[model samples]
Target: MGWRRSGHFASLTEDEEKKERPKVASDWTLAKWIMKYLFKDFRSLAIITLVLVGLGSVLALASPKIMQVIIDDVFNTEFIKSIDERFNLLLIMTLILLSVAIITAVISIFRTVLLYKIGYNTVKKIRTDTFTHLQKLSLKFFDTQESGRLISKVTNDCDKINELMSGGIITSLIDFLTLIGISIMLLVMNWQLALWCFLFSIPPTLLISYFFKRRARKAYRKTRKTIANVTANLSESISGVKVSKSFTREKRNIQEFRTVNQENREANMKAVAVFATTFPLFNFIASAVVGFVYFYGGWTLIFGSTAILKAVTIGEAIAFTQYVSNFFRPILNLTMFYNTFQSTMAATERVYDLNHSTSDVVEKTDAYILPEIKGHVKFEDIVFGYKENELVLSKFNLEVSPGEAIAIVGPTGSGKTTIVNLLGRFYEILEGNILIDDHNIQDVTLNSLHSQMGIVLQDPYLFSGTIAENIVYNQKDVPFDDIQVAADSVNAHEFIERMSKGYDTEVGERGSKLSLGQRQLISFARALLPNPKILILDEATSSVDPYTELLIKKALDKLLSGRTSFIIAHRLSTVRNADRIIVIKDGAIIEEGTNEDLLAKKGEYYRLYQLQFKDQENGSNGH
Candidate 1:
């Protein structure tokens, strides 16, 4: 049988397809955009950091020049006649060098601290904002995106961006400045030597960088994808470990995880290989330029014509060789920056893409706040589907009066739960409107609309916190008395009090420590504590034991009184006392009446009752 799936938890959906497709080449637009928006707030800190880096670079450039001065002039016989004067001059030069080193170190340390602060703050804001946006997004968004991939975006992607900001940007700037400063100094010292070095060095530098950039970008992109896949697979496997063990699929899961991990390792190896080869190639080129300078400079000093020999001093040649090394170092840094820039741009593109995605359901600017609902609800010609051209509910219409209790019963995928989902605005209908107390749900702010409603799912979720905290979640200043009263009303207080810590007991992750029935009872109490005008119990007791079902049923009587309640149940016996029972098929009401009236009619509801509850009743009688 073909069935339409309704929730994201069923499988990875369309968004995963979009993520897997090759990202369009960003051309650094995303990098620039990140700087423009995310880092704009840290402009002052960035400016200060840049200034400090610039100062440090200038000081570093002066070191080679000082070495030239000491070699050419400080020790020259003609320059320093007295031994005492020479000693004083040497001491002064040494002090100057030491002072430069000390000051540069101080500046470097301060700048690093500032950059770190800026990077962390920027990521914190981005992560917080991304999470906030994710929360505001429609259920359709979460339905399509993988949770692990989203976690990677908030965590791993943000870290890459931080690396770019904290290290890549400022270091690249300083390297470029230092390269230019050293290049100019070399040319000024001896133009002929400088010209030859540039001729030999620049072409090879450009060629090597050009080749590596393309490969590195591809490698990093692949790494990101594979790692994300591994993370998503791991998260799914861990969450479903119980199911895997129950089905004895442990070996299969392990093999699948191994495949994903191997892919990630391969991708990372490719990226590392590119970096490993590129750095040494750059160093070889730089060293080759230095070797050429020493050979030519030494040959000129020993055997060239007098003019040539005089033109290049020992000190000048030594300084020029140092300048050549300095120049190539920045070129190498810039090459590395190319790799960093590409990876960072890819991460930034993903983050911005998520930020720009508009939610399917959005609140209007002029949407009204629903004032204290009386729980009168109406569904007008609702047509809906979870996927394209596949209608789950077709032109469905229903009206519920204030204080009425409704039981919606149908086969799987018959759209029984879809009714309440639409009522909650979890998914927008393709056509028509849902209204509460005559206020169109779409015209009312979602916050105000949801505030007055409580939902208890078949599989209820409980966070890791004390029982009291979970019961009073999001309710401001809820008194202990109210919490106790709510738990007592739902028949949860007795079991809770029997626990070692009572309400203070920790529930553990997803309330795993508690039995399913206990969790459901707490969920019911949580829903009831809010004192909502409307309550929805979607198969709340379907998975519980018979004794637990009795407890739930006793609680439901008080909970449903004076409140508009919709109960979607698979077990037909549970809905027998509902004020009205609606039998739905293919998203439309097939029968609607009081339980006895529908049973007397012997229509769809009667058939369902007979097939589900009557058989069970006969078995009990036989026993």
Candidate 2:
């Protein structure tokens, strides 16, 4: 079993395989989409945050200028004649600066809280929209997708977008405005100092930014891809752990994990290398600019009365140095913000594509609801294939009267399951039509069609919940008595009652707590609970033991009473009583009739019965 299962869990692709769908051309579109969610959904919070940012910037700019006043005006003996008046002026300026600092701190606190609310609210909407859109997509979209990658999209990628919404873009915008405000203040006080500082500092800042932008973008994108890959590998490994242990493949599994983990480490190291170099370089440039300001300002102040150098006050000199520091602060902040922006852009690209990806199967805008049906079905010259240029079923046709029971038998890959799938309209037929009760399936709403049908696959899936919950899934407001009745009908009530908690016993993930037969019984109970007009059991009894299957066989008549049914099974004994036995080969029906009639004909159906059913009869007679 382990060797057989190995191929299913083979190494997965690191990226989602590309398809023919259109790609997003630019990161700007994703940015705008995120902003739209932030502002449109929670406009009040967004507006309030912006206003606080603007007010905080104003106070930030004012506090530094007030320092200049305190130095030049409050303490100047020439400006104020009396000592008491100068002291009084000093007290007032001190109080005003204190008030500005206090107000700025208060605003900062409120702005931080608002940003959190905005970030969470925006992300909630994005996650919800992504999930809702995914639900609308056809099964074909999911058939080729890796489950781990999809989980990564919903969890990790959305988290990156949340980071951007909370603190990345909004604060960076405020920082830019603060940078501009500092520049203007410096120029107003002294243009020569401001011009000289810009010449030395601005060029290097721009040069560094230009040099790292592309590298950081590529590095961060690789990191995002690698992380998704790691997540996918982890998910697959956990799912296949049983098989791996069975085959003693622990060492091999560990080695495979190490390979993926190492790739992730390398990608992160590349991004971190860029991050490590950027801020220090910016900090060095800032320190040099600040030093130059102090040096030049000191020379001007010391060389007063000289024709070549302008006189500068001590107060102006101190303020000029502070302003230069403020100017570089935003630049450094921008450098840091850009790194985060690059990662967010990578995440946004995957999320945006997922959100916008169109479903290959779509219902018409004007498609009407399918009224309660009588279960008459028709497949008129159907043609389809799971992949391009391949045909699983071609020029195939079948008509089932209301309440007829059909048993489809064929060799593997002979399109037995595809015939039933077409009846349910799970896949679109390439060149034909499926009609239920004279209503074209494509013309009817999917919900109305699916609501009246019940399907039980070969592998029964039960969610993690109490047995009662699993049995009553998707059918709201069902009475406990009704649940017991459905379970009893399928012979599940006896075992369920034997458990400590009876119907309330937890089934664990995918019903792992129960035996395979028990899970199949629960699935049968679930399917029957709906009392659907059409019932499909595709190898539904394959997992049940002979004893449990015998119990199910006894109740088959009651389960199929007054409902049209299609049964696809490998065991010849299961379909001996169907209203019509259709023997298919190479996607075409080669024999069709009652069991006795087909046996008399000695055709494909007779041959299958002789090969499969004769052995079962002989073993039973011998016993």
User: Each candidate: RMSD to true structure?
Assistant: 7.2, 7.3
Candidate 1 structure quality by residue, lDDT tens digits, 492-581: 999999999999999999998899989988998999998999999998888877777899888888999989999999887788899999
Can you write out model 2's per-residue Cα lDDT over 67-183, one digit (the tens) per residue?
Answer: 888888876656745777777778998999999989999999999999888988888899999999998888778887877678888988898888898879898888988998898
Ten contiguous residues minimizing lDDT sum, candidate 2 = 9-18
TM-score of 1: 0.89
Total clashing residue pairs per candidate? 0, 0
Each candidate structure's TM-score, on Cα atoms with residue i matched to residue i, is: 0.89, 0.90
Q: Which pairs clash inside model 1?
A: none
Which sections of candidate 2 miss by over 4 Å? 1-22, 78-85, 210-233, 252-277, 304-310, 614-623
Per-candidate Cα lDDT values, in order, are 0.83, 0.83
**Which candidate tops TM-score?**
2
Off by over 4 Å in 1: 1-29, 37-39, 78-92, 214-237, 240-278, 302-310, 617-623
| Global local distance difference test of model 1 | 0.83
C-alpha positional error of residue 584 in candidate 1 after TM-score superposition, expressed in Å: 1.3
